[model samples]
Target chain A: MNDASSQDPEQQSMPPLGADHPSVARILRRWRQLSGGRHTRDPDRKTLVACSGGADSVALAIALAQIPSSCVLAHIQHDMRTPEQAEHDRAYVEALAKRLGVDCAFGIAAVSEEPGNLEANAREARYQELARIADEHACPYIATGHHADDQLETLLMHLMRGSGTRGMSGMRPATPLGNKTLLRPLLEIPRNEIETMLRELDIAWCHDQTNDDPAYVRNRIRQDLLPLLRRLDPEIARHASQWSQDLVAMQEVMDERVEATLMEPCTITDSQWRWPRELLQAHPDIMLGYLPGLYCLRVLDNEGADRITRRAIDSWIRSVKSDSNNPTEHRIGPIVAHIRAHEVRFTPAESSELST
Target chain B: MNDASSQDPEQQSMPPLGADHPSVARILRRWRQLSGGRHTRDPDRKTLVACSGGADSVALAIALAQIPSSCVLAHIQHDMRTPEQAEHDRAYVEALAKRLGVDCAFGIAAVSEEPGNLEANAREARYQELARIADEHACPYIATGHHADDQLETLLMHLMRGSGTRGMSGMRPATPLGNKTLLRPLLEIPRNEIETMLRELDIAWCHDQTNDDPAYVRNRIRQDLLPLLRRLDPEIARHASQWSQDLVAMQEVMDERVEATLMEPCTITDSQWRWPRELLQAHPDIMLGYLPGLYCLRVLDNEGADRITRRAIDSWIRSVKSDSNNPTEHRIGPIVAHIRAHEVRFTPAESSELST
Candidate 1:
């Protein structure tokens, strides 16, 4: 542990340890900002850092340890890698944690194959394992090493899937992981900086051998699409990362507008919801564009809201605008929109009779 | 050329000429919707179809001819192509126009190579020629053959450049092309459907030889990135196109909010603009996220507002929050943000002292 603050008064004139590495300082500052300027030595500020023994996570751990808060290194051994490689990863993470003078927790990921979604399943399993580790360690936050490049890759993947603004908004800096707050303090930092910082500190990290497998779509995007995009625009990653931040900001506004204009004015329950058609007509910009998908997510709690199509929303809007006195039903995920002359009502498909 | 509506009453009892191919009718209906249901035979509704002798443009011409309104096929002979190829394109467009019983217009595009931006320069030159031809032909609208695939391509291009929602919104269905309205009636239609309609109608179109040239970034993206994305998700094009539409809708909402909240309350002039600090603090979601770029556009009329960066905006916001009574200035595009105690002022850099 490079404890720069504990230097002797005899060496007070000298620059602090790690002063030459500005990236470490940036990481520390960013983490503090993300945590809302909490006291550095706050007893409640325990974070379990998820480390794959990669340069990104190792650098994160190094910077995070400098904070006076309690820090723990966590590793999830997944089934995708061979036993030898997995052991090597765990060993490297253990040694790195020991060097940082932090306790380490190791867990095996029960990654089960789900037809064509093996990669997604593995990620879910890994996160679940991380949550369990955080629980055992009594940490309120679990931090990851996702950086700007990963943010770009995640955004492209969402774009490829035709996800609208919500998906393109990319990962939030801090979001919920089970009951714990998942913190990604280095999201705005680039991958090169993480690797460069590690090299400067003479810290060795193990490479995750499974990352090159083309079986995962993310690898293909990273290997093929990213390089091609970089060639087209060298600042693409920086631009995209910034765009992601902007989208997040924009999404925050949209969510607030939707909540105030649509959700608040509506009568909502677990199985049924109703909104005034007059309000819908008054704010077509919000009603026709953002309300449908958001209503599904916030009101109905539909997890597959992404599957809602633009055509479906258009059709629903048409129904909402129709002057017919009779009721018309339109499907939107698990719920159905029953539009009448003065109001638009939504009911779960199983409770269609309730609308009648 | 396929005059389905001119059938005799006896033949009208049967199916129409294009009844089997529903796509042509879809195109015509879409055109009428795009034009706000103007009288079909209105002489003022003349449109200059920017035909490149490609399948998409040819299909558009075929559909537009079905409308009773006047139509003229326009072609631009660009320097990027050989004279022989340019002549071939012009000849094909002329023959098609003649076959459709409409007039044709031709113009030469003096496309100058701008260092490494030959492709962009050629496109701009082509559009300028199109606008000129539209003006010469007394056409109020200039229609293009940009379909959903092109929209997806555009969104990806903007994404690579790290453009926010405004860029990712892709091409508008109708926007100002010089003095004329540029209409993309086939924007929602897919490229495959356009080609299929052309093949079904037995219409011949010349392949765009320059399209496959790898020197152009668009060509590389079309060939490499699009195909890779399609493999990941077969409906990626449709999804991105829909996302673009959603983004356009979201942007409309954002624009309206910014106008009503920020622009409406501001004291703006050609060289100076001031916004209340209290209003800004009240709506950080709108003020912090959208006001910077949009203010550059709406207030300063700065065409390069896209160059207004997130960092610049963040810095400006920080200054706006500063408690200092002394004025501080920050550069944003061609204008400078001056932060004062009660308000934030913007002035052209040449006129900075006015902000004091």
Candidate 2:
């Protein structure tokens, strides 16, 4: 018997439903269900797999092929690397796609010589190409094999860069990509799992030499920093992924609060926009969050809304309490909060307004 | 020439005020003026310094002593390391308080044996002791020397531990400690400044050996991690402190939304409660934050609303959307948001209602 049938039927089949190997397939099935079932017109949906032919994406393509789904591979020639190596990578991805009985599409884009916008421009160009392919082929989704490890790396990058909650939340699995959905089914799978799957499938994938170069901050993190973190905790990637999920949930709540605060109706008078002081006082915690914008209004004497400091908010609170008998106005960031006629008023300064 | 004369004349001479130390004296004078120059007999006004005889707290105590107000010092002996060292610390604080002509008090507490609760326990014990001292002296406020560095440390700890916005907010300058207010006047000052002040004042301080010990996670962070971070960016601590202040402001806004979400009236029917599906969907993010407690409500059938999980919340959202037409009551977490005839209704599960 061949290797596929040599093992016990139970072992050779799909393994147990929730087994490690089954997890990838399970996730793919879930993605399909969530996306309202698999596409039928294409039979084997000509998915333009954004494969640099790395272990993660190559493993993804191999596993996907086993699931009786058709896929088409797409490789972007980001001419950032040596011309010889870039061509080699493109050839590898195209050859792999052909071996898997799928058509291949390739695109080349000259990276900008400009310093700051290089990374952003390359990403935009690649995505723009992928979106075009999906539109032309009438494909429902474009799959990218971003694993749990990649998600963790993204999260750590955001944290290191001092990003807000939204940034720290990391990537979503099936966000809208132009007219099509960008499905990242491999996101729940760990990096090691992909490597193991690649080995099991007897697939060879190319590694990008640039990943080892520490000149780029992201490469430094992925190569040096993440290894150190893994040493500290072998499950660091999983933990980071879980943390991102939790933050994503928490961020939703924060976003809602921000919306509610913005949507709350207030009468903008000639002097100030009057809001209930009692209501504000009852939610001191909320006031702390709003203080940054409030500070800009008062300190700059510009009625434009901007971020304020906690100290400014505290000072404003004190002012409101101390000057109860008099009309007291305190600026926090670009917003002003004043007490007049027994009511508190909040307004954005003109200079630091949201428009500016 | 005397040490006082050797110093800059501006630094040596008090501001046009009777208080000591030009800058601190100026602040006090301004505070007094702000208070309408009415000095109330605040016999209960006492400052409890969490002194390890460190430069930071020493400077804080010295500054507080120079104020035209009386204060009592309270020290906590956290017997985590050598008991003898803790005793030495207590003695140093006692002697310093005596030299400054202020009342001194101390409390001894065994460190927590549990791994996870070590820091939490020490903090709880310290505050509990402070409260006891305040009650004994009838003091309405307790002061600690939590400088900017400490705030940064706190923010980093919370961030590393995957805490939400509130956890990342660090310590508040003035928060209620039992019946009394816990104040940190040194929060705005940098650690180096406090050290300089101590040197200038010729005040001797003891350094805690445990601060450098790596057995504790925070100590490891302070000794090894923070230095690396500072090397990467010298202003890391300042930036982190600023970030914490911003988060505090944001948290205030979130607290208000949470309250508003809770206050939205809902009817309870039997074992379940319903809220308007539309309303919940309108503020999905807020609902996500409130999901952990809701999940606990469903699983335990007892709703002592505490923590919620993202998965549990997503599941609830999906179910709500799926069963929108039926309008049947379903348990989410500790609280249930169900669709009703006129509006959405929410109530704690019968079992877990007591916790709320």
Candidate 3:
């Protein structure tokens, strides 16, 4: 590890370690830090990396290739862009992975087949395809190319939506996806640094033309908000990620309190999700905290998180958090709330399932 | 008061009550909501309001005047700007306060005599002067002109500096200031609306040149950062303030945990602050929570909050939170620690204070 304390005796905080160091060195340092002090990925364990043939991912792929760990590159052609561009990206990823002696997994996403927002569809399909690829390759950790710039944009996007602590916590460096662990090695690294690293290595990368669209809020934040923030504070991007990181730590501690006090003793049965009536009515604030978890468990079909508004949550809370503890029926989307004597139950909207 | 449910039956949340209503109505609704169902401030009790000749505070003054409450206007001429301009502002405030039948307490700030950063000095002096005026007028609540835009700017400023949850929580709607309560009736309102309110009323307000100078970090944020954020999300200003409000709630809960678990049983006697060594060592995370409370109680000179940096807090935590329970001493700014036996002791930097 780079001892910034030793380098600058006055500087106490982390001081964005390896920020001033070389591009490859910075990535190596950051990757090691992400590995929970393991220093490097074990040679025996093969890792799957999601590469989009864009500068950030391509840069990450290049860095990982230089290391000793075995790697598998997964690329999904969303086909949202032109066919020629998609094919070009696929060919590029294949060639790059092959050159680095890494196994490559390529998939075509049914972007048009998917419903809702194009970005959401592309993102969900990409993640699903990556998970499948990781499973096939027996890779536990699937690293991505989400860098500091992306982190800033994500945090800002959450702020614009008026999201709570969880949303403002931005994306985690590591998270479980189905049975596999998804990782972001370049998360600590800035976008320009990744570009610099690839430039220094004399490697070219493909650009996604769709990213330029102002229709996407994330794109607008990246292309606009970040620059203005930077003008006010030169290191705004770094701080944006850092602030979220601090909030993430704070959230973990607070989440424990919520779990211990508010959301405790709630059980998930195969047919119905249940919470005690007393617990449901006691703390109304925790209802907000518990909404996302319950929604994911209840809602199906697609990513309906955005669709599941606060109204639905409040409506649920009001239904259960009532004076009379009698069995009652309430319907919302594809879920049915069966409020009973001791507990509140949530089942499928279809009454036939309840009958079964 | 506007009951949003009555106005919009389908709306889940309050949906910004009187948002589309007249400017005065929106401000009045927000003020009433701030009162937390008290309806309005008691006419019997006087409330001191800190007003600059600026539009936001001027509009707040105008709105407050319309309501049935005793208001005392408090204005501070920093003397940092031109004498002519300062005199002009004082005259303007006096006339406005008189026109509204509100008692005015205008004061000149000793900003030049104070220490530290110009902005900090000016702010501290202004607040101190307001508190004094509030005390003189026998007022319990001192209202400030910190609107939603200012709150957003404050939050963004803290984030850029990598401040933790305490800093990110932004400002309080009400806080205990000695025997009085510091209030922000206009906190929920936006700056643009405040301007619109004044403009619609055909009331002219003084513009402070200091606010336009790019030398101040805040000015840059207002002129540059806010516009860019607005472009991405039109309601960014409102959301920023709303996000902070949610964080404040979360912080309150977490603070209870900190008080119950960590800061509980710690004692302060004479000039010495004591905490059990085991308790201090066991919870390093809670140290961040406990720092502000301890610092405020310990530090004597003015607010001194901005002076109490994270480095100083961490240093104090580290000095006391060590393995050996030996008689050792460490100093941080004006505070000194003497670690011995089962308890960590904190005293003034100089031993002369103990002798005195």
TM-score of each: 0.88, 0.68, 0.79
Question: Can you write out model 1's per-residue Cα lDDT over A1-356, one digit (the tens) per residue?
Answer: 23433522333355433555788788777776676565654346678898998888888888776642357889998877778888988999888876665789999876654555677677788889889989998988888988988898988788776675677789999887778989898998878778888888888888855355445668778887788777877777777777787678777777777877787888877657788877776776434557667667666576667567756877887767666678778887666787877888777666675536
lDDT of 2 by residue, A1-356 (tens): 12112322433545322224564566556446535565543343446677888887776665444433345677877767888888888889888876654567777666657465677767778789888877766666788888788887786566566554345578877678777788887776678887876676566789854244333667766766566555545665665665555556555666555445532644555535555655555454443344344334334453444255446666777655454667776766666666764667666555325443
Among the numbered candidates, top TM-score falls to 1
Candidate 3 error regions (>4 Å): A1-45, A66-69, A112-115, A199-204, A208-214, A265-304, A311-356, B1-41, B67-69, B112-115, B199-204, B208-210, B265-356
Better of 1 and 3 by DockQ: 1
Runs with alpha carbons beyond 4 Å of true place in candidate 1: A1-20, A38-43, A113-116, A209-216, A285-311, A353-356, B1-20, B37-44, B113-121, B209-215, B285-311, B323-325, B353-356
CA lDDT of A72 in candidate 2? 60
DockQ of each: 0.51, 0.17, 0.46
B-chain TM-score of model 3 = 0.77
Pairs clashing within candidate 3:
none
The true-versus-predicted C-alpha distance at residue B96 of model 1, in Å, is 0.5
Q: Candidate 3: DockQ?
A: 0.46
Best by DockQ: 1
